[model samples]
Target: MFSTFARIRTLYSSTTFTNNTSIFRCIKTIAPSIDQCSNPFSGKGSCGRSVPNDDYFATIHHVSNIVRRDIYLERTLNKMHISRIVNSELVYRVLRSCCQHGIESFRFFNWARTQHPQYDPTTVEFEELLKTLARTAHWETMWKVVQQMKAQNIPISPSIVSFIIEHYGKRGLIDQAVELFNRLKNFGCSQTTEVYNAMLFALCEVKNFQGAYALIRRMIRKGTVPDKLTYSILVNGWCSAGKMREAQEFLEEMSRKGFNPPVRGRDLLIDGLLSAGYLESAKGLVRKMTKEGFVPDVGTFNSLAEAVCKTGEIDFCIDLFNDVCRLGLCPDTETYKIVITAAAKAGRIDEAFQILHRSIEAGHRPFPSLYAPILKAFFRRGQFDDAFSFFSDMKVKGHPPNRPLYTMLIKMCCRGGRFVEASNYLVEMTELNLLPMSRSFDTVTDGLKNCGKHDLAKRIEQLEISVKGI
Candidate 1:
């Protein structure tokens, strides 16, 4: 038997053994039958992408479970024929799936490299394992992985470095983050726009505004073009610290230097304020924009409206909606959905109806989600007649109720003690070839029997048995 587990020990002997002894022991124990390994998921479409079959997923689940739970993983895995099917994508996915079991994941990663030449790991696999190690704070092992990457002559990208830096900053290891940022060249990665943005984010996380500002200036002086994200990071940072005026100044200064953001400066400021929970400031900015006839980006308007609506300011959102529309801002379906949902929740049904009509007039088809909340509001107000009429109207207008809608209607009917209506809807669902939930059947039948509608209860029970084939 060409055992993968037996070869893993030799592979480790040839490589540096900086990892713990237990990981080595785990590696030595894995014995896969690589001679019989075959690529069952070798089918490909015209695009040349591997189309994985069910066996691929089963193998993935099997291997991940073994890595996660099996005490003798090598012995268990050695019996499986998985060597040829192992690729970088599979390795990345398995690593991601074993997210909480970092050490075991490492053991599996090491074991995988010894499976076959076909299972040679790539940069994707390395990056994923590095992320797993970093996220689990396995620093020594992470650096050893970096050395392995170096030994393989794979140049580390700035993006992965930035990821590590961000994690370092999050853990308040700012010094480590700065040190890594300073050593980009040693890792053979250029200090690109993405790396600079990440460093700025880290600096701002610790409220080091002055250092962040200097870093951006250094980035610019070094002739690296600042992307929109670079500007947003600083602006958002300032707003988060309640320094709106400084944020505005930074934007203005950047604009003067010919680095205007892709969007309007005020839009960024308002969005930053909203993100920072300075709702009143964000609202104040919107009010100013409304008066100045400046049409904020529809996205900015949507964010502002949605944030305010969450605070029970639907009336204000309504007014803001009208003002922005008058200013020639075309609201997307999401904008209307936000206002309608907020209005419905606040019992402003008429307002919600008006918005829905407008949305329909604008050629937006009313989906179930777009209209379900209105039905819920009507039910809450005990307007059973109106709710039923509205549902019928929606059906007539070409929006057929889905299974979930029927299920919801049935549930609501049962809750309201309208057993007759519930039975009627249950029958309608069967006629439409929709299978009502077992719980729905039980609830309606129980409610019907309690209301002395014994025949209807028997009919519902028969329908349940017929649909479920029980």
Candidate 2:
């Protein structure tokens, strides 16, 4: 029911585009009227300033929406009145956005080619379209695109083949993936390490570990030096299959063969266990590593802490943090963020404050994210005065709160029936040259009126009108 590039000649020959001045007039309206609402910085006010419209993003968004929704895509798109000729970047962006709908993307691509001024779809557009088709399992259409690429003299790169092979593996089309892997040379694409890794991942996806191991050996023999990802892939695969012993042995065997990974195999194991949802095993391994005084990499430790915290084990994560600190692993901001957020959410505001102080002592500047949780915790406990004091202190001492933090504070104030305070924050935002969300204005306006502060509400309305240029 859908048209491909093979039908482009017939489609283009029958269709005609008019330079109707009315059509061009409609183009302005199509350039996204919601730009003002979606981007608060796109209006004529003190707070909301205008910026030049981004034509590429606007065109891609418009074309993608049409392609995704319209069944008769070519017909609907032919009626589109773009003010300027479509470029290669615009074609690629539109194709990328319509990735899940291969046929419609193809139809749109063909339609783009038919546009006046001879729009030539470049290699980039073709490559992105091929990936879109492959990802959507439109194998027939994907092959058609490959043939088109060949005819256009655009050689397929190994990276493109690698992407397709990985997607094939994801979809469990193992045999097809293998066939493509074996035929890369025929496609004039070399067997790069990326291709090997992609093929290895496909084999591993199907639990063909024996085959994956054989391929690794073949990869080494072919003089393609394996990278960290090459080793990590097999380790993660083995861990996923519950073959922990085999995963460890394989890493050791590779190391003994002079193929030592850049990072430690044990770190990979913990990561693999974590990724495979073996949380308890990951925790046990961390404990064992800490006992032997082997300080886990900071990144690995942070990952473990974050994962454990998500399982509502905040206390356990805190203990783990203490253990790692003792091992001289200085926690990064992310480490503090994870713990602070968890502690605040768990109502341990005191503990959250302690972590925030530690972060500051370590010379890390407190951002809104680091401190917002504590504010929220104070509000949750009805410590409104404390939250206000904390906000004031942050403004005077640390990085000034950004637009989002002010928005959060304003909403929280309205929810607590502190309409006057919320209105004050709204005005403060304008003073700081930050554009507040339109809904923030509505909230404060309504709240003030409800509390019989109609005078204050009217002033806020006039301020909003000035800021929004309404």
Candidate 3:
């Protein structure tokens, strides 16, 4: 039996059957007796059926043909005509493979329907295709597929309905989503909480707070109790729309209904308050959250610190950082980055360096953007030696100097009339394949020529041309 399978596999490998007739003939030749294996078409197998020694060979043959058919469809989709008839089972496997390739699924779907009028896709196959369309945001194609299903009287499942609703809602097609939800029965689906929640989420995502509230009333009228997730969705929607008053009212209503509004709701409210410049209110909420046994995470604190820093309350930012440490919550790289940015902006170079060093000790590899602020501060203060040393350290730590840093150094050197140093940095920039701005190169080249270094200026010009060609 094993020898038979090996020979068949070799035959398939050796032959390239472009048309379905040849492939089908090959399949028929290798197929074992019906009594030898479980019936592939019966959808059931009787117990104690006699097993054939060549059943494995038949199974391998089916799998190999399926793979070959898939490859043929993928490569010859544009040119090959489906003239030869294939079984529904093979067509189903080909459809599934097409779904995995995204948009090509639609092409194959259209081709399959036209080519094999007798082979109607099952519910599972349609569902998989719809899921693929939704995931890829092929909205128009999805609607067309849905229409085809309707015309064929195919039963649409609740999961498929939910996927369409959720995607339509996310794409801001709220009316279409709602219409689909209302027509659930037409599609032979029973309305459930999952469907209702999907609709509610869609409304919330589009900031249709009034529509969401009305939908909640409708849910109650239908005797469908709104779940905790339903209320949280509304609260988040209101908060995101900057309607803190309404958001808080919804939170109170959630509590009255014997549901503790989740931490996400409170976080959204806090974020909204901070964004609206209600710093005092935002801080009060943080305190309230802690008292309610819900400690704010590092991200929440970092947001507050950033907002406080923007208001020039550097002291308060420092106090918040100290509080984060006292609570035994280890500061993340973002937390340190925010503090460093604030310190650098305030010209507190020593404090910025201290924080940066601490971040490095805590295993955070510094980004070049993080170094920008302090580097600019050092350059402004005329601390040339300190700036060069910092640049050396950055390179040693595996961050070679980037274009902006080189540009800064070149501009500073030009301003100070350090033509020799500027020319050396220009060469290094070229060596690192980092191109400075054309204006910076022109400025340095002209400065060197004016300083009587004609040879070096000519070389710099040549380097600029070579780098540009690359």
Candidate 4:
């Protein structure tokens, strides 16, 4: 009997029941073992048998009752209208349950407000509802909720205001975000450093670096001293805008003020410099950061490696990668991938494969991205046999070909007048349910027809239709 209960407890703990209904179902399945009485309150066992007095059984019964109550409330809230004054606690519970179901909480909130003139939701409850609306991107509904809060003379918290500002900025509504930031006081919230940072981020997101700088000046004038984060934001903004000189100037100013820019800020400038073809400048910044006791992370090295590779400086990138390893920073999968790609692009296929072999021996799964450049290089050089051999090896190693890769191969075959191979690839794509883009398909079809393979062209078109149906 004890073993049976132990098994039941293990199952209960391991199972993840998603809803009240699943919980109720689980309870019903388990109840027969513990529910001894025909009447559960009769204090007897099943079939007139005696049962043990165990706390586990009592706890299970209590949990079952809670699940049952939640299920009942969900059904009742959907069907029953609130005619009398409902307690704020009950309203909060219903709102939470509605949120769980992804149902709009506004309807219940409206009903709760009308329940009684004095029945106001607590700030926490209101904030929870606002968060739900924001998460669902129901911006208009969120505004209505805010307006309702204002009508009730409830003070808007800084957290809520910041959330709205961030949301607006994310949606590219820069003007709306700025308007909200400016009206914090009108919303009965004070502008803190958090709000200031949020506004700066919004300004930076829109590439309004001049405005962000002006805002920083205004913050300083208003006695709101800019912190490290403030300087970082300005630096990042200038870097993103391709104004590396301005970014460097800001870093100097930050240092003069006795605050060094953060690692992330430096990384941003390094990325910007590398992207703008200032390789020497980016390397100098890295040396400066190291001199300042900031160890460059793997990401920083990877970014520089990838950027240098793009500029056809494969040897330089390899040396940099070796330096990273010598400094005791382990290269990640992305590091190997970038190096492999660069080697392949430089037509050093043997070196690329050597790196891939080393990475695989190091227990890294060969991702599709790592294979893409090599395959493309082979295809570009008209090495069809080698490309197909590698493609088969990729499948054997559990890195199955994806849609984009298949599309590229098919397009390459069609372009090279390998009509039979193109048709075979098209069939394989259809089997995998990967529909080629219409443009790619049209190109292949036209190529096949021009090559006098009318039947293959028709077959490809038929496969396209089948994929669309799927």
Which of 3 and 4 is the better model by lDDT? 3
lDDT of 1 by residue, 1-470 (tens): 12323422232123221222221122222423333233322342211223223444556777899999998887787777555456665677789898777788888898888765667677878988888887887777889999999999998888888888887877778888899999888889999999999899999899899999999999989999998789888889999998988999999999999988889999999889988999999999889988988999989988998899888887899888888888998889889888888889989899899989988998888888788889889888888889988988888773778899889898888788887787777776766767778899899989989999887687677667666656
The whole-model lDDT of each prediction reads: 0.80, 0.81, 0.68, 0.67
Which candidate's lDDT is highest? 2
Q: Which sequence of candidate numbers ranks them by lDDT, best first?
A: 2, 1, 3, 4
Lowest summed lDDT across 10 adjacent residues in model 4 is found at: 11-20
Candidate no. 3 TM-score: 0.55
Candidate 3 stretches greater than 4 Å from native = 1-175, 182-198, 205-233, 240-265, 275-280, 287-295, 305-315, 415-419
lDDT for model 4: 0.67
Report how far residue 54 has shifted in candidate 1, in Å. Answer: 6.2
Per-residue alpha-carbon lDDT of candidate 4 for residues 329-438, written as tens digits (9 for 90 to 100):
66789889888888888888887888888788878878888888888888889998898789878877747789888888888887777766766666666555566677
Which of 2 and 3 is the better model by lDDT?
A: 2
How many clashes in candidate 2?
0
How well is each residue in 1-470 modelled by candidate 2, as lDDT tens digits? 11222222232122222222221134545333322223322232311212234443455677789999988877776677652435555577688888899888888887877763545667788989989998889989899989888788788999999999999999999999999999877678999999999999999899999999999999999999999889889999999989999999999999899999878989999988988999999999999998999888888888898899889999988888878888898889898999899899999998889888889899998999889999988888888889989998877767889999999999899889988778778767776778788899999999989989887787777777766655
Poorest 10 consecutive residues by lDDT, candidate 1? 15-24
The candidate with the higher TM-score, 1 or 3, is 1
Q: Which pairs of residues have clashing backbones in candidate 2?
A: none
Candidate that scores best on TM-score:
2
